[model samples]
Target: MRGADKLVSDSLATAKRIIDPDTPVLARFDSAFYSANVAKAVRAAGVHYSVTLPQNAAVKKAIAHIPAEAWRGINYPQAIYDDETGRWISDAQVAEIDFTAFSSKAQEEQLAGRLVVRRIPELNTTKLAAAQGQLFDTFRYHAFFTTVEQSVLDTVAADKVHRQHAVVEQVFADLKAGPLAHMPSGRFYANAAWLVIAAISHNLLRAAGSVAGGKLVNARTVSLRQKLVNIPARIAHRARKLILHLPTHWKWATAFDRLWHNTLSPPQLATP
Candidate 1:
């Protein structure tokens, strides 16, 4: 937990160096990152954050204070497929409360933010055990802390935006499933170098898919690698030119050709 706080501060510092200082930055984290130091660092950085909050007494009490009318219905930007139950979840409800976090800290050090809570129906396991009729009746709650205010984004929009943090897990999964499957070197610096290379390769593949612009744009890293990068081709020379001949009737030949053309073609210069 202590390491997470410093990591967040270091990451934001690196981002600040590269990104325009005026550009708004948004930091997203899971509950493991919830801390006084983390919140303080975010506030000092002049950035916004949406961090999942653990269900503690303080958070629950804050949720209780919000009027029932404050809750608003929301549809997830994309359906979440539950692998365990083989189900799709597309809707939930969200609400927010004005609250101060790190209240245990010195009064000057406490941070103020909105506590956004999302609730969804819990599947009835009792019916499955009894082999009887089921009820989709009970609710399971999740809450998060966000520095965003109503003027910047209302409750519904804020919740929707925060839910998008799940996409980062997809990226982590991609890395783990690909170049990061094994750390080839025992040395710390060597492992770090491998990580850097892996990230660059991953981003390059994503950029290629984005340039190709189709279903491939959203395809996973492994899928992109198999479909586009790992292809059978032959090199030949004819008429003082080198030609790369790719297999005929390849499944992704068209998309590959599009990416190739886009990459090799020079940028057009605008006349003033």
Candidate 2:
């Protein structure tokens, strides 16, 4: 538990080093993580976080404290992004209403000017009714909580928080692709080692992408890997010098060159 806690803490702190001071961060975890100990640590660091709440008694009690009218009159929890046949929806639904009490201590470190975050799922269904034409159904929920007194808890803030969580899955993906693929020890230790190595690889890849995709506001790892690491070049000798030949027409070639020269270039290959 201690090791995992530190791992989560370190990842958040490392990401913090990369973000601009003006940008707000939204840390996330499962409901079990919504404890005072973890929250105190995060709050002491003055970072903002949003975690899932299990339908425990504490969380339910908290929901009970809020007026029923607050949830009744809102947008009824629609998705900001949808892939189905609609642009906007007003009557989204929840399968059931669960009451859970959870510690919101993670945000204690945040100042008054925090942001709103919401989560809604659009493609889920129970085992009843339309089982044959079963395409997919959507469900969504929204609740805004922030210490900020003056700011509006609107869609913009919620969107940022909601979108931030997508990165967590990427962490899992990188683990699957890299270190988590194998380890030197037993399965358990190998899995642990894989996580550590994958996390490191993920960070390096993110950094390289940022460097190579400079000034592009939304450069991501896929683009960077395609443009940089996946370079399809051949090695040859020109006069007494060695030369590497690859396509010259990539839009990011110049940036790639700069990235290679400034950082990723002239490195010895590691043994597989």
Candidate 3:
């Protein structure tokens, strides 16, 4: 999905291309992008979605409305107290309670008050033995937030979104393993060409892995080429003018041929 400071209209337009009214719940997990305004864009797609609310005054005010009794034993992410800094960390517990319907039915809005267990991760380490005493530290807080219902805190919806931040991280993993890793340069056209090539490679890799063979497979083409392309062979003269001495049995030869044909073959002309 397109991110950054782009308006919700852009997100909605992009969603319009693929999303239909029949789409089920779209579980969106974003820190800063989910709000009543953004919720409108998703509602336009006529699908149910849940996302992390930003820690702003509006959300905080909504959270304050929930009674402390509802938050009794709930914690966000589970974090142990830090004795040195007296802070909770990287662990928390949480609870959720839906608001009285805000937007329409498909675009429902909810509020939750979560007991966030956070961390004060001030790591003090030294490169040299002498510098151990003069250590620089970093502090971090771990917490969870929710809007599901208080009665069902143990259920999936209450804590599942916080656990799935890693999925978004995986998208960055794909970007780093692709064209976005480096800054393009030289002339504008050259950089554009490079980006075009890298983008094509990335898309082809994804298409080959997920959509090509029915089920998505882990042995994607990117890894396949890295492993197979390095085979060493000798060019020689045989019964004919020239021949290439291939490996004993090329397992990927068939797949490679299919890939080449699909890539180089001309587009099929449509019949009038």
Off by over 4 Å in 1: 14-26, 46-48, 57-67, 80-86, 103-110, 123-136, 234-245, 265-272
CA lDDT scores, all candidates in order: 0.86, 0.53, 0.51
Residue 249 of model 2, lDDT score: 79
Residue range 41-105, candidate 2, lDDT tens digits? 55555665555544555444444465433332235354344435245444332211222223343
Of the candidates shown, which would achieve the greatest lDDT relative to the real structure? 1
Task: State residue 190's C-alpha deviation in candidate 3, in Å.
Answer: 6.4
Clashes of each: 0, 8, 21
Candidate 1, 170-201: lDDT as tens digits: 99999999999999999999999999999999
Q: What lDDT score goes with residue 182 in model 1?
A: 95
Per-model RMSD to reference: 3.6, 9.6, 10.3
Tens-place lDDT digits, model 3, residues 203-241: 667655443233334554446445434557789997877
lDDT score, candidate 2, position 232:
85
